[model samples]
Target: MTLKHILLGTIGATMIAAPAAFAGSVTPAPADPVVATPVAVALTGDWTGGYVGGQIGFGDVDAGGSDSGAIGGLTMGYDHDFGTWVLGAGIDYDFADITAGGNTLENMARLKVRAGYDMGAGLLYATAGAARADIDTLGNDTGYFAGMGYEHMVTEKISVGGEVLYHAFDNFNGSGTDVEATTAQVRATFRF
Candidate 1:
């Protein structure tokens, strides 16, 4: 072959091989390091404060037999929160006209201490305390109460809840009669 033919063949071969060589040597840019960012969720408000509320309930009183009626009252309390747990104390007064054994039971009051588990916008609690009940002819008698309750926050300042409580009084009015009561109530509260 003449020099011209040889030169052209060499040049054509170089041109075709150049792209292949470059393609083999080149690598894609390292994909941007996959960064893992944590996502956060919003939770409900805190439960550390003072509160005032009202409740209405119906209960059966057993003094020899059973008598049932409606009861309503006002409640006030303060709570301290510690992470997942809460502690509190409260007082309530109720007016009722429950009759059993030919006697009318009227006013009632309770002082309680409570402990609860915090559940974001809600609380589950248990309470126990001293109670006093007034009877129309038998005067006032002292007793004890225990209960469990659940409350849910509807707003930053308001909550709604329900509770079931049991009360027992032994040898009421110096007589041989005993009293036992169970109450189920719904309540609404405002927090400060």
Candidate 2:
């Protein structure tokens, strides 16, 4: 065979066989493995009942001067939860012995109205109401107080919280002295 004829024949044979040769070597890519993602579960509680609790903390009073001491008290209230919002009324009492400028403060009481946001198993709240304070020799006076608190449910019937309050009594006991007090306390409550 001549050189030109031999080269032409060899090129034609390769062209016909190229597709089948590469086809057998081709592969399909493997599909990605299935994956599962985790989801978080939300906590919920119903706070539509009566609750009673006890609190203990420190109090600082400014009645012409400043006096600070330990104060403790008992609290009772009823909460009605409206989905994410809660409203309630409560009454509490604290026994204290703080002396300011020779005046001894004996005990205090409050009639409170509370509004809060329900945070699943917890409640973040604000409180305001009338306060009655008794000071030795200065007698008793009525005033107003506002505060904030947080309570978390520990069990179906028990919860714990902390509160900080500001109380103001202008012209305390007819003495023309404005009395202002701040108190911080921790509380534990039982639901009924």
Candidate 3:
């Protein structure tokens, strides 16, 4: 035979006999579906239900006639979650060292409302409420506040966050000095 015919015959013979020569030990692959074990994940903390916590922070309040340096305060609040809506109401007390002449300021209280969403990792919220703080020169000036905050959960029962608030104040003591106050604070909350 010619070289080309011999090579072709060899290739044809190999192809025709290859499958049967290996058939004695050839095993079919399993056709079963893969079963993955379900993993169990722990839920750390839920931002639902009634929550009460206290906070202390510093703030500056300017009421046109006088400017307050640094104010210290305490706060308590309850927050409720109705799935998509997180509703909260709280109050705070602040003692400010603000005086233009010779008057000492007393305690300031604020009643606030909050609306927010708990986005798995943290709680993102916006707050607004009526605030009234005592002044030496102007008595009590009532105002409103708008702010935003993010609470990162560090544990099952503890979270820390920072927030900024803008306050608009009414004129006091006929001074026509409406004030805008902004405060930034780091806060830690204990969840029970």
Candidate 4:
């Protein structure tokens, strides 16, 4: 072959072999570093706080000897939350026309101290408080109450609930005795 043609052939062979020499030996160029932007979340917090609400209660009252009547009225209260536990105290006032063995009561007031556990879906709770009832004759006075309740979160901003309670009162001036009573109620609460 001519020298020029030989030189050209050598150059072509060198060019072909150069890429093969580098095929497995070269490191790929580093990819551009990716920076991710943080995303903000709208809602995050412990649903533990103080709440105030009013409720209507239905209860039976036993004041005089074997006395019973339907009672209902208003309730106001506040609650404190620590994670899944709730501690609360409240006062409920009710009025009922109660009569038994020639006795009648006009207005009754019952105060309660309550505590509960939040099971995520609802609260399992118990309450105890003071009860006082009034009669036209001499203002019959007494104290007693117990209850178990469940409060459910029906919405993000509201809660609806139900409860069953037992009550007792002592008429110190009338018969020197305590009487048994029962109660049930439905309630709703708004959250902020």
- Cα lDDT over the full model 1: 0.90
Query: Which of the predicted structures, 1 or 4, would earn the higher TM-score when compared with the native?
Result: 1
Among these predictions, the greatest lDDT belongs to 2
lDDT of 3 by residue, 36-109 (tens): 99996554446764444444555665554455465656666777766665777777666667553344456566
Instruction: TM-score winner between 3 and 4, please give it.
Output: 3
Which pairs in model 4 have colliding backbones? none
Q: Estimate the Cα RMSD of every predicted model relative to the unseen true structure.
A: 7.4, 8.1, 8.7, 8.7
lDDT by residue (127-151, candidate 2, tens digit) is 9999999988678999999999999
**Per-model TM against the reference:** 0.77, 0.77, 0.64, 0.63
The top-ranked prediction according to TM-score is 2
Error of 4 at 127 (Å): 0.5
lDDT of 2 at 36: 85
lDDT of each: 0.90, 0.92, 0.68, 0.69
Which one wins by TM-score: 1 or 3?
1
Pairs in steric clash, model 2: none
Clashes of 1: 0
Instruction: Work out how many backbone clashes candidate 2 has.
Output: 0
Model 1 residue pairs with clashes: none
